[model samples]
Target: MNLIKTLIFDFGDVFINLDKEGAMANALEIFEVDTFPEELTHVNCRYEMGLITTKAFLEFYATKFPNLTQGTILHAWNCILRDFPKHRLAFLKKLQAEKKYNLILLSNTNELHIDWIKNEIPFYEEFKSCFNRFYLSHEINLRKPNSNIYEFVLTENNLTPSECLFVDDLKENTDSASKLGINTWNINPETDDVTQLFDVNKRLF
Candidate 1:
């Protein structure tokens, strides 16, 4: 390997543990839906693609389930909020302070998730400041599992694919980046913590 000069990270399972199933169950219960509705799934896809605004998303769900209040829907949507371990943040910060490889965060997230992070995680602002660059799928209108997204980051940052390493929880996303020549680490948050990847200080110099 080229002794990676840039580190690209995924947000959801990679940084924080997301309660996807829990959130969906809550949403289903609040709406009295039998299973994950197609509309709900489609709306989420749109949300992930940044095609719809958060307010619009809430309204859409509210409209679908007229009996549900905006607050209830919001709560269900935000049920996925989980903790971002301070140790992980601390490790990344150490790399930042040491002027390590350019660090970037690329996440496929939505408005509800963003809102939850701001309100729930007290260190959200501090955590974000550690990255050299941040790219949210919803904000960028592009998402992983798509090669173009990987290309966009490479082209925009003027980074060579061979010089960067990407860490993601999803295999599909890693496949896309790999096709573009970016080295990848398919990390399982349940089993692997990112700090074990490399010596932060050593990687920098």
Candidate 2:
């Protein structure tokens, strides 16, 4: 295998653990619904893509569930995010110090998620400093599993798809990158660790 020149990483599940099921339950309870509404999913997509402001997003939820407060809606939305492991940060820092490969963070995250991270994680800045480029979906107006987003990163960074390794927790995201000729690792958060990068994909290194 050819040596990897750049490493593109996903944040949720890969770096920070998420309670996806729990968050879904929380949202259902907050909205008082038996199942997730289709409109809510559309709004969420817009929110993630930065097509809608946080205020507008919250207002949409407020209009749907008038009984719930803004705080409750925000809390339900942020329930998916959990702790950021220190060891992963240490591993990333070491990689940055070595400067062997260009490190990039590409996450399908919104303002509220980032706001929670900044307030909850004491070393949020320190962790971010390790990355050569940090691309949040909301900030970039793009989301994963979409070819345009992957193409944008490759074009912007002047990186060859074959020389870049993309690691994401979602199969669809990894599959999309693989189609672009980028090496990919669809990491399982339950059994895998980002710190095991070199050990897991030794051929690339």
Candidate 3:
């Protein structure tokens, strides 16, 4: 809360709602597996980090689950993403209008998921415009829970971690930021709304 001048946000579960558990259960049922295999997760991480192309990602899943087609795998993968609330976009635009802080979006997203979002959310560009910097993991070749990603943001923006606040739904993501002296709110998506930011973290404001 040391005079925060920047706000770094996580996209999933922060602005856009996600069905993580539901998506997992759906994939498990389809794949006939109780838990995701290590190789599957590895491929996914590579995909998210931009080490693999969209075609390669789909082919990996299709080849591994030979009984399923690429389209089926694509559907299962995208099912995790859900609604991007208009209220959240309003909140962001309001923040931008105030011009009190720099707004940044740092998300662990991939090509397919973003393509789907662009088609589904008509105001996607407007929402993105509110941010000073919009970074997708695949585009940046970096993903969170890794300290280097936070460092990259800080270095690129010439920001001091102590003067920045990172809001994320994932504790691990927030924890990583906290280590670098960044103020953080590990928001609970079920009970918390991003529109209530001022009230929830009033001390920082």
Candidate 2 lDDT tens digits, 1-205? 5489999999999989999999998888778789998988999998999999999999998898889888888889998999999999889989999998899999999999999999999999998999999999999999998999999999999999999999999999999999999999999998999998888999888
Lowest summed lDDT over 10 consecutive residues: which window, candidate 2?
24-33
Model-by-model lDDT, in order? 0.85, 0.93, 0.93
Off by over 4 Å in 2: none
lDDT of 3 by residue, 73-182 (tens): 88999999999989899899989999999999999999999999999989999999999999999999999999999999999999999889999999999999999999
Write down the RMSD of all candidates, one decimal each: 2.7, 1.0, 1.1
Best of the two (1, 3) by TM-score: 3
Supply the global lDDT for candidate 2. 0.93
Model 3 Cα shift for residue 63 (angstroms): 0.8
TM-score winner, 1 or 2: 2
TM-score of predicted structure 2: 0.97
